[model samples]
Target: MHLYAGKKHQKYILNDCPNDQLLFAMGIRNGLTVSIVTKQPIGGPIIIRIKNREIAIDKALACHITAKAVT
Candidate 1:
């Protein structure tokens, strides 16, 4: 599903992502509240704000990260 911009939610990690080891080292673990900063066009990357840092991740990697909308 497409995540909306300016949305706030807690990331839901399904399994350990060995490919993104740096994410955990950077403190981007499960349950972390992430804000959808912005999204690129034509299935481009997505800029997510987490822990006060804004990181751009591609669509492929974005699929691995899931979250639920915060109320």
Candidate 2:
């Protein structure tokens, strides 16, 4: 199954990101959370809501964002 937009996923703690994702990781540490806001049907950037900020990230980068399924 493919991941669609408007889905709420588990948070990937900022402390968990690798060295390369320093900036992305830092944001999370500052009370930031992310949610999939939108997705382009034609393999476009994935829009994510981080706190009050909405950032559009490419599919590849989006996948790298880790989130666990909540039961």
Candidate 3:
């Protein structure tokens, strides 16, 4: 499922990402635990948390990232 499908504050693990280098720079990678911090309104960026750092990424990019909920 896309990253956008995850609920805020719920942990997820990235399964696929189109831009590896870009997400790597932001500290996101396969197998890492992440969570949605906040999603901005109307075409704004989506805030995500990885390891203790929070990063904001545009919705377009976010839609390409696939994640699975962490049980």
Candidate 4:
């Protein structure tokens, strides 16, 4: 699996990911340490984990937020 680290976080995007299968695949491929905080209060950071490692602030704060919002 390929990994990309962005400003705030690290992620691997599987294009055309089918349904919730994306999450499952990501978890397994990356060691199942992911979480989604969709309805948290504003300014509260959303936590996304991968392979027991935390992502960067920029990727987590920017890219991850954008992806989660859209999906």
- lDDT of all predictions, in order shown? 0.60, 0.50, 0.85, 0.33
Worst 10 residues of 1 by lDDT: 9-18
Q: Per-residue alpha-carbon lDDT of model 4 for 30-52, expressed as tens digits? A: 22324332313454444445556
Rank all candidate structures by their TM-score, best first, as comma-separated numbers.
3, 1, 2, 4
Quick one: best TM-score, which candidate?
Answer: 3
lDDT of 3 by residue, 1-71 (tens): 99986789898898888866887787777787888999999988889988788899879988998999988
1-71, model 2: which lDDT tens digit per residue?
12232364433222233234644554643234455667777888777666678666667655554553323
TM-score of 3: 0.89
User: Which stretches of candidate 4 lie above 4 Å from their native place?
Assistant: 1-34, 37-40, 55-60, 63-71
- Give per-model TM-scores: 0.64, 0.55, 0.89, 0.26
Task: Report clash pairs, candidate 2.
Answer: none
Clash number for each model: 0, 0, 0, 10
User: After superposing candidate 2, which stretches have Cα over 4 Å from the reference?
Assistant: 1-32, 69-71
RMSD of candidate 3 to the truth, in angstroms, is 1.2
**Model 2 TM-score (2 dp):** 0.55
For model 1, residues 1-71, the per-residue Cα lDDT tens digits are 33333343434222333358766666666666677767788988877776689877777767766555665
Clashing pairs in 1: none
